[model samples]
Target: MRKTHLLGYAGFSGIFIFAISILLLHGRQPEISIRYDAMSYYVYGQLGWLLWAGLLGLGLGSLALAAGLWRIQKGAYARVGILCAGIWGTGLLIAAIFPTDPKGSWDQPPSTRGMIHFSAAIFAFIAITLAALFIAHAFIKDGHWKPVQKWIVPVTALTAISFILIMISIVSIFVSHGAPLYFGLTERLFFFMSLCWIGIASVGLLRSER
Candidate 1:
C-alpha cells in the first residue's frame, strides 16, 4: 500500500482501537458511572494501562490523519486546519502523559498534574473544533473536496454544537460545585462527533488517493 493509504488506515484503526478500549474499560469497571464520571477516572482503576494505550492510539491517529490531509490539501485554510489537528493530537498526548487527579480530589485544590491534564483536554477540544470548521471551509472552496463538504459540513456543525454542550456541562458542574450535569455524556458526545468527522475525512483521503 502507498504511504497515504497506510496513513489513512492508521488513522481509522487508531480511532477503532480507542472506541474498543472505552468499551472494554467500561465493561471491566462497572463501578465507575460513565454518565457522571470523566473517562480519566479509568486511569486510577485496574487495566488503566489500557486507557493510556487507547489515548495514545487516539493521539497518534489524529496526527496521522493530519499528516495525510496536509499532503493532499494546499491552501491557507487547509494548512491552518491541519495545524489545529496536530495541536489536538499533541494535547491528547499530553493528557495521556499526565493523568487527571483521582475522583473526589477535585473538591480540594487540584494538583499541578491535574491542572495540566485539564488544560490539555480543554485545548484539544477547542483545537479539534477549530480543525473541523476550518477544514470544512477548505472543502467548500475546493471542487475536488466538494463531495466531502456535504458530509463534513453537517458533521462539523454537530461537532460544534456538541462542543458547546460540553462547555456548558463543564461550567454547570463547576458552578454547582460538582453537581452531576452529564458532563461525561456531553464530553463523549463531542468526542464521538469529532471522531466521526475525522473518520469521514480520512475515508475521503483514501478515496481521493484511489
Candidate 2:
C-alpha cells in the first residue's frame, strides 16, 4: 500500500507491456503478417509497426490499471476489471473475423493481436475475480453511493450497449460482402474505452496520494 511500491510496480508493468507490444508487433509480427500478398505486405510493412506501438500503449495502460486496482476498493477493482476485460476481449471477438477468407488463403499470415487480446481478457477476468473475493472479506467497505451510480452505472451501461454494436458487426461480417480495412473503428473504440477507464483509474490512484 505504500505509494512508492504501488506506483513503481504499476509503472514497471505499464512500461513492460508497452515495450513488449511494440517489439512483438514490429520486431516479429509484420513478417508473419506480410505473407498475404504484395498489397498486404506493403501495408504491414508500413503500418504494422505503428499498430504494434498502439498495442504497447495498451499494455502499459493495463499495468497502471492493475496497480490502481490493487489499491482501490474491492468493488471498484471488480468494476474496472470487467470494464477492461470486456473492452479488450471485444477485440478478440472482432479479430476473429480474420484468419479466414477466400482472397486471403489459409497460408496468409499469423496475427498475434488476437492472442494478445485474449490474454488480456483472461488477465482482466482473473483480476476482477480476485477483487470479488476481496469484497466478500468481512464488510467494512462503503455499502453504496450516488457517485458510483453517476459514473459506474453509466459507464457499465455504455460497455453493455457497445456489446450490441459488436454483435451487429459479427452478424455483418457473416452476412455482408467485404472489408476495406484490416480492422474497424468499433474495435478501436473498445480498446479506447478500456484505456480511458484504466487511465482514469491510474489518475485517481495517483491523486489519492495528495
Candidate 3:
C-alpha cells in the first residue's frame, strides 16, 4: 500500500515479465541465433504476443516506478533520474507501437514505421543509461548507499558502452550491408545490465526509506 513498496513491485514486475518473455521465446526460434538475433524479432512469430506483453509491462512498470520515485524523493538528481526513467518508458511504448521491419527487410531502406522503431530503440537506450547513472549518483550522494555506489559505476559504463556499440552496429548496417558480428551480444549485455541497475536501484531506494 505504501508508495515505496509500489516502486519495488514495479521493479520486480518489469524484471519478471521480460525474463519470462525471453525464456519462452528463446527456444521457439532455434534457427535464430540468440547471439545474433534481436529480441524484437520474437514479435514476428507464433508467440509474438508474449513479447508485446513483456514490452508493455516494461513500459508501464518503468512509469509506475518513476511516479513512485517522484512522490518519495526530492532533489535535482532524483528528479532528473526519474524524468529519464519516464522517457525510457515512453520509448518502450513507441518501440512496441512500431515494430521493426522483418529480417529480409533489414537490407532495404527502413520504412517510415521501421525508422520510428529504430529511433525509439536508440532513445530508450540513452534514457535508461542516464537514469541508471543519475539514480546511482543520487543514492551515493544520500550518504547511506556507498555499497551501491561502488558497483554502479562499472555497470553504468558497461551499459553505456554496449549501447554505443549497438549504435555502431546499426550504422554498420547502412554502411557495409550488415550489422556488426557482435551486435546481438552487445545488445543483450546492455539490456541485462540496465535491468539489473533498475531492479537494484528500485529496491535500494525502497530499503533506504525503511
Q: Name the top TM-score candidate.
A: 1
Q: Which stretches of candidate 2 lie over 4 Å from their true place?
A: 1-47, 75-151, 177-183
Model 3, poorest ten-residue lDDT window?
Answer: 140-149
The best candidate in terms of lDDT: 1
Query: What are the runs in model 3 whose C-alpha is more than 4 Å off?
Result: 143-149
The sequence of per-residue lDDT tens digits that candidate 2 reaches over residues 1-210 is 666346534634554554454445545544443212211122244444444444445444454445544555456545555354334433323323222222343234435653454354445434433322333221223332222323443444444444445445534634544332223344334334444334434444554455
Error of 1 at 8 (Å): 0.8
Give per-candidate clash totals: 0, 1, 0
Considering lDDT, where higher is better, how would the candidates rank from best to worst?
1, 3, 2
* Cα lDDT over the full model 2: 0.41
Error of 3 at 16 (Å): 0.9
Error of 1 at 197 (Å): 1.0
- Per-residue lDDT of model 3, residues 1-210, tens digit only: 677777768877987898788788876866656677788888888688888888888888888778877776688887898899899988988898888888656667888988998899889988998887777667666653555667777777777787788777767776777755666777888888878777766666566566
Full ranking by TM-score: 1, 3, 2
In candidate 3, position 94 carries an lDDT of: 89
**Candidate 3, TM-score vs. the true structure?**
0.90
Error of 2 at 69 (Å): 0.8
